[model samples]
Target: MQSTPATTTTKYPDKPITVIVPFSAGGGLDLTARSLEKLAPKYLGQPLIVVNKPGGAGAIGWGELAGASPDGYTVGITGIDMLLLPLYGSAKYDYPTALTPIAQVAASPMVLAVQANKPWQTLDDLIKYAKKNPGELKFGHGGVGSFPHLLGEMFGQAASITIEQVPFSGAGEATAALLGGHVQLSFVNPMVVKEHMKNGTVRVLAVTGEQRISDPVLAQVPTFKEQGLDVILTNWYGVAVPKEMPVQVKNKLSEGFKAIITDPEFVKSMSNVGLKVEYLGPQESQTKWLADSQKLTKTLQDTGVLEKIKSQRK
Candidate 1:
């Protein structure tokens, strides 16, 4: 009798990998996903197909990502929302462990911005005025419980000021509200205020990063700490897969993403949009995800936002 030949398993990533982007098609996350797709064939040896799953304020997409099979084929972009949904008690799964961050791809810190036409030439001016006027000043944010909103609350707490928060559908609307003077202030992306910085339309008083940002336009902005308020929160995006993929497969995907993000062309593309190519490997990425989630939980609790979110869910 002839000996039977042994079967061989297929190599990891032999086919296209699907990356779910839980937002609209034209947003910054979508742009980053598509931009990475351009370099995937070279670095990943397979294409990355980005699927938009926009809804539920990112809950719909994040839910899908958390539920995706543990196989390496399906991954998704995870960020602040992924970490916050579970805390809000709206998530279908516990984000802290259900998903594993493969790597962090990009980041952009929020800036404390006011219309240049306003009287607050500096953060001090804004804080002092808010103190004197109490809740007279209003600020617009992407949405309730969003990073911008929570960061705004944190800032208010740190500065010992009282201000009203206006929640919009998203950052774009909030930025527009700021520009139209519907709100006296806003926590906006450095990029959102970048163009206006040139014409002196929007004045960025401080950035929400531990250190200053690198964008020529935004670098001039001091950090919250530098300005005497220790409030800091960064908007970051990273690729995440279910926490149960094969170790080798996870490592391979991490390597691919790292290569794509580090590519000079990719770096340049991100820079052009005023986003930094902030890369962290799989282990480091997962650690950062966990840390950010924990920190946000504390911030929310301290600012009464945790209870606020819980109360709203009912």
Candidate 2:
């Protein structure tokens, strides 16, 4: 047999890059990804494309990105649900661990909101009613096992009530459902519900974070803990590639994204849409992802969902 020469691959961004947004167009994640798209080519010297792969509560698109070649040409935009999906057996691929953390783009915690005409004025009122009539009240989310889903479960546990859970595709849909009286409440990120809230279509009850969000629309709403509920959660969105991506490619993507996140125009755009600006480079993102995942896993284990998921996997 004749000896053959070894083949070497060229550097990334050698051609067009595809950035996948695992949600519908016009949503918070899609908007941020598109905003980054405008500035990324300036930094990387190559054309970037935004592809929407919305379904399965972001699992369908995430799986597509996971199976893509680890050449750094394919990347994805994901949110907090990426951390909770697998624990509920919804994701087709393991997140956090399967995706290489390039850098965080933006993050915002979920806020509990009710229909404008609903009688429950405060978080306490809602809890009291739910306890009196367990499972009579419904709370909506982006989808089953999403951030809102977990938040609903946690609140139910804390309040000692049974809350009927309703899942939608995104916050837009969830907002619509809440307004249309399909559901009584939702724990949605303020970014997605800002417009409806401004018009008084939906009423915010309380924020789910440790501190109250700075948005003027939510200035009156208090944190869940401040209302006597110890529950705390955050919704963060970030960009990532396959875990096996080249280090140089990851570094370039991280620097570009971090730069875009801190850009004056980008920050303004995100803030206008109610997204809080918080940039986490690769190392910090990885550390947080691991720690958050551990916390979520423990929650699942306590709920008996982890063993249920493993049994289904087997």
Candidate 3:
């Protein structure tokens, strides 16, 4: 069960603030929350306590956040999934409307990876093989309607190719499948395959987002656009509280979170874990939320992927 936030006092956050992680411990968001925990007291006047509420593909933790009191002490970690889950029946609340965005902290760049022993040396190499044998090359992803899966389908459209989709329980499983030669390709987090690449078991071909990753080693990999495929997909993380807070309280919380996320130490902490800290304030974050929501919705609807996700949730 989820724990309740401390009671609201005459002043905001008279007690510790709760930052919820929808996923289990040891994941990217968990690392992010732990970093914030160390930095919160200096900024927010109170420490942040992290609570794990994993289940239902993030619907559980986010749902709890949306239902939290709008008293400025019940914010939680958010992601691109926050906007996508409501489109399906999995989530009862729309994150954009139900919660107030505080700041965008980090993003995970997607990469196209293949087993090292495979014949693909570059994005072009993989494209040529896929064109030669349409629907013969299979790629693994977190699941249907997931960012990695959606990116895979969109890539085929942009590159004018037909490849098979093989969904897994999550990106970790999908990456394992790639390493074991169960699939020809996988769109996974760059960090997930970094160690495998070092061990000469995986070869990353191209990145999906506009920029290369911030990691010095991963930054060398060219983006999809550089390789002639104009596809951009990003998995971003942020902090948000329930909506309709007093204006002053909202601003205070927002500014505090911004300070913590952009601090030099916070930046270094995120960098060590393969996350890039890109801080966007409340207004800018909301603009991005609406833009991403529209773009992804159109992509899913056009490709009939939206209906598949809706059906799966039902």
Candidate 4:
């Protein structure tokens, strides 16, 4: 009898995996990725390296991720900006088609915040004032095509108010501008303004999620729906690999990330930074990405932003 040759199965991640973050280091997304870096290795059986490739309002880094080899070794942290970038004619690749969703990690609702001394008191007060003084209220946001900017537009449309917008480099800069009174309002993350809230330097009027947030500082802050305005914008973060990644490799990556996002310590760390762990598996992530993209596309179109971007592209 002839002896059969023994076969050995190759591990999906025998080498280090690189997780790209499309934001600058020390930012919320980067911090979240760093947190996962510490936790993923225990489940992945290999080290996870976080690389920051921030530029072009996250278009540069996300485009790189979309174009990377579909071997599952390279993946990235993507957010709502990824969906907005292409609508603005700024992204090099389309999402879900250029990249495969692995899993959603965290989500943070946008807060309609003002300087603590502003005296708006409530979402109704702010809208009433904006209605009386159209375009007098200047709102600061991260940039032109960012989620904050979109939320600002949505707020204005839903409330039938016209307000000016001041675009800054990033949320930190926008928050700084708001603090200095350069802008009266800002749609920022609760975590970004939480410290100020504790010190009574900022007052969050309302959250832009479908439901009220559970954060202690924001527990009293009602949602737009609760305030009688139909607006919901959640900034979500997720992991995605290049399109066409092998099924087994995708499953392995998804499993590792699901474990990391749901781990108690990991969840606590993310919460400390104002991010809530909202894990969505591959199918759910993809579905949400597509749905959000469609919704935002219609918003841009209805608001004339899509037309403006198209004309600019020409």
lDDT of each: 0.83, 0.80, 0.83, 0.85
Q: TM-score for every candidate vs. truth? A: 0.87, 0.89, 0.84, 0.89
- Compose the digit string of candidate 3's lDDT tens values, residues 1-314: 34556665566667898999886665566778998898998999899999988766677898999998888878899878778788775688988999989898987878999898998898898898999999999989766666787888888888888988897655566777888899999887776677787788988889988888767767788999898887788888899889888888898998899899989999988877777888999898999999999988888887777886777657
**Which lDDT tens digits does candidate 1 get at residues 1-314?**
44546549776777899989876665566767888889999988889999988765577777888788888889888768678878888778887788888889988788889999988888999988998899999989866677788888889889999889888766677888899999999887786678888898989999999899877878778999998887888888889888788889988988999999999999988887788888989888878887888898888888888887678658
lDDT of 2 by residue, 88-129 (tens): 767777887788888887877788888878888778888889
**C-alpha RMSD in Å of predicted model 3 compared with the true structure:** 4.5
TM-score preference between candidates 3 and 4, better one = 4
Q: What's model 3's TM-score?
A: 0.84
> Order of all candidates by TM-score, from best down to worst?
4, 2, 1, 3
Q: What is the lDDT of residue 64 in candidate 4?
A: 87
lDDT of 2: 0.80
